[model samples]
Target: MSERMTTATGTRDFLLPDLGEGLSEAEIVEWRVAVGDVVTVDQTVVEVETAKAVVDVPCPYAGRVVALHGAAGEVRPVGQPLITIASLEGGGDDPHATYREEERAGSGNVLIGYGTGHGGSGRRRRRPRLALAAEPTAATADPTPAATATPTTGGATGADGGARTAPLVISPIVRRLARERGLDLAALHGTGPGGVIRRADVEAASAAPAAKLAAVPDSPAAHVGLAPAADGDVVIPLTGIRKAIADKLSRSRREIPEVTIWVDVDATGLLATRAAINAATPDAPVSILALLARICLSGLRRYPQLNAHVDTEGQRIVQSAGVHLGIAAQTDRGLVVPVLRDAQQLTTRELAATLAETTAAARAGTLPPARLTGGTFTLNNYGVFGVDGSTPIINHPEAALLGVGRIVDKPWVVDGQLAVRKVTQLSLTFDHRVCDGGVAGGFLRHVADCVEQPALLVANV
Candidate 1:
């Protein structure tokens, strides 16, 4: 005798939510569940790497996991059904009804309620895949022992029982040489501690190929031969933050007519003011950038038009009631401009602390979505890199971006006498659509005046 079992009639599909960072897609780094694993709402089921950092994707449905559409290293488009969950027997009306019932009871998890319902029209648009072409192998490959690198404990492993090791843990300078010469990671024996790879090993391996190739003397006609056609172009697929940056920059450049104004001032008083402020408050020290940030905020307060953004769709100018100064931070990944809200209200010390916190978070790839958005103006410090002055590109949705150049000691005539003075350059790029040449010039002058005479900021405030 055989017993018949009724199959579940409905299945719930869990789609990816907009990770709250304006990211369109993410690459699946790892999966924590299998086909038969049971998952609860808000339980982390997978790890995804977005443009910013690695984020854990939580399960939106509570049931038996049916399937996973993509594997690790595959980039999944946003709003695509990633996993399917089969409703448990006696599990209420819908399989993904965890938060709905909770909401009815007036209590629910914060993020669980933000999940999208199952079985809706896919909101993600599929991007065209780029073809991966195999190039011919170069001759004179270095003869080195090929060893099966094993991953250390706590490191991620592959499915073949073979341990997965990090791609040669070497310094940046060494990595550059290894990449330029096409050296294999497994071939080089590391001289560093605990068999860890070193830069010298990579350099030695890289130099071997060049030395072998350099022996062959080139003929006079060979030098005349059509200069090795621009070492083949590389096509990089634009997605996520890079794609967004390109689109935004293009839109801003095309739509917004920009005018730039520059000014040079003696920032000696500004440095002294910062030192005094920092000396008074040991707990909260003011940075040079923070002092400039405060001056910029004060100048923006005096000239509110500088904090305005052009509304293309609305065909009008949108002015911000509050000053949200965006500090441009350069990270290994890319440039991220995190906003400091209510910049005008914060004192020099508070501004410095917030800037330090936000910039650190930005570099660590931990800046929240709210902190990265809604900036009214921007301050870009090219001076740190020894750059004298540069016309910085205006951060989109913001009317103006102020560029701060390096402060240097230069001879200047004060009261008809040549004296060494600490001078710095300031450049302001404003949207001509919202701000005219005079307004932009006035704004730059105002900022320069505040920096030149730090006491003026207090008077203006």
Candidate 2:
């Protein structure tokens, strides 16, 4: 349905602007203005959360808000009218009309598709009504009620076994939540207005059986022929960053023919170098991850093939000119890979500072969307989890991901003699479509070589 509501007055509808980088919708976290409040151009009126990050949406036109569309916590699609504003008393001309005029003149002050001489609200066409259907006569007619009676399409499985109806829901995030949990939208009753299913409902439905089972006595399991859970289980619904990670990983597994290759590296030299650097520059301490990142950058420079992505749609392998290195950081919002743009150019100290800043921002959920994307390769330091190694799935759309494991002391043959040294496992998972084993092996070897001798990076630099 058209989100715009109009009257005889000079009114302008401020539709939600496209937040760019494939963001289709956002949840209204809060509204800065209410109805009847006067707002200026470029004034942020709402804070919204996309699948990726939280963003503030600014209204483009200056006027008195005649109406506000969505409330806090409501997810609204892009191009939907966020607020309707009317011209001031005796202003005469509609701001929308002025915007359209400027749009025709090729003004660039507008959001991507709004008032920028592009498209307008493109609503889905309604299916034609059956001709034999009885038309409402004057006494029986009720247009408003009839329009309100229209059914909405929503989630995955329906209540009717084979018959599917559109799930009555508005938020994609909610739909994603239900779909992930395998909950049937039609089977559940909605508590929202107009019988719309919501996130809370899906979460409750998913948690219901677990909660009931938890409440059941252990003695009854034998009578009921059910095995009792050894440990109490908690069903945490995937949302926000957790959900995003799940979706990306699932897609990566499905689409990318990934192969993991690992090598044990004697990181005795790398650790000593890091310690020496920190000792000399206590104020600007270098992290182990930074040194490893520097090593990865050097490796990427030698084998640029692994430092690129495959565009399956275009059937092309796009090699990035410079490494936009993605550092995998586990934050409160789950795992996020924040990219350091043009990392190939940054010195070890600069890389350490940037890595620290980005990691801090990611953990704080304050990193910008730009910093969270466009990675040619990912460096995952799962060593923080104290694991020896893992066959990690690649961060989708990227050609490869390098995993670093915990550095531990292990006995090894050094100079043909038994010796203990700091050792770490390095795993590289690469997309098979972009390169073969030869290229992947070489890249992994380069990284391992650097770890074994930190001076390798200095020579490459």
Query: In lDDT terms, how accurate is model 2?
Result: 0.72
TM-score of each: 0.71, 0.68
Cα TM-score of candidate 2: 0.68
Span of ten consecutive residues with least summed lDDT in model 2: 124-133
Misplaced by over 4 Å in model 2 are 1-7, 90-239
With candidate 2 superimposed using the best TM-score fit, by how many Å does residue 460's alpha carbon deviate from the native? 2.7
**350: Cα error in model 2, Å:** 1.5
Clashes of each: 0, 4
Best by lDDT: 2
lDDT of 2 by residue, 150-224 (tens): 453323343354545655654444544555555655567788777777677877888887533212123221212
lDDT of 1 by residue, 66-103 (tens): 78879754689887877787766664564445643432
- Over 4 Å off, model 1: 1-10, 20-24, 49-54, 88-235
